[model samples]
Target: MSRYVVSFMKDVLGGNGRQIEVCQKTLEIDASSEGEATELAKQKFCKVEHLCEWSLHADRIQIKSADFTS
Candidate 1:
């Protein structure tokens, strides 16, 4: 298994009135492939009840997968 960085992105206007992609959450997953890593991320990474910041600024949640095969 290899390491993968899975990120959940949120596009929102910052305090400066500029749109930026904010990483709501990120996880390092040890999986074989990108697809597997993404699946693992989705299954394991979930929002906590107390963590409402992600939900508030996120218009949409997008998952990104990057493999660390080195």
Candidate 2:
């Protein structure tokens, strides 16, 4: 079992057509392989751009890169 940080950008309901947004969050997951992690993230977010392994320090996971999507 390992923690991961999933960061992604998407358009949410707002004014002026579609607005670009960013979402970064930490998740605690357990799986037999990385493939399972990917699948879990996909199922949770449904539109995740990047899902990377993360280290849990206290109660926060530092975000590495969250500029891949926009």
Candidate 3:
């Protein structure tokens, strides 16, 4: 398993069809793949926030491999 960072993002639309992604929350997870990490993060987030859907809290999700130096 690899460490991944999952982010819950909120999107804002501006003038002329401009879009911006604002990160609302981030989670560190251990998963075999990026897709798995995203799924796990969403489930965990929803459970912790007492929501039935992950979309209720954020517009989208982003995941990346976490780089750590020891």
Best by lDDT: 3
lDDT of 3 by residue, 1-70 (tens): 8999999999878676899878878999999999999999999999888999999879988888996779
**Winner by TM-score:** 3
Clash numbers, per candidate: 0, 0, 0
Q: Compared with the true structure, what per-residue lDDT tens digits does model 2 show for residues 1-70?
A: 5444444333355676765453445444455455565556555543342323322112222323222345
The collision pairs in model 2 are none
Error of 3 at 3 (Å): 0.5
lDDT of 1 by residue, 8-64 (tens): 777878899999888777777888887888776666655432443444534444444
State model 3's lDDT. Answer: 0.90
Please, what is the TM-score per model? 0.63, 0.33, 0.78
Task: State the weakest 10-residue window (summed lDDT) of model 2.
Answer: 54-63
Task: In angstroms, give how far residue 1 of model 1 lies from its true place.
Answer: 1.1
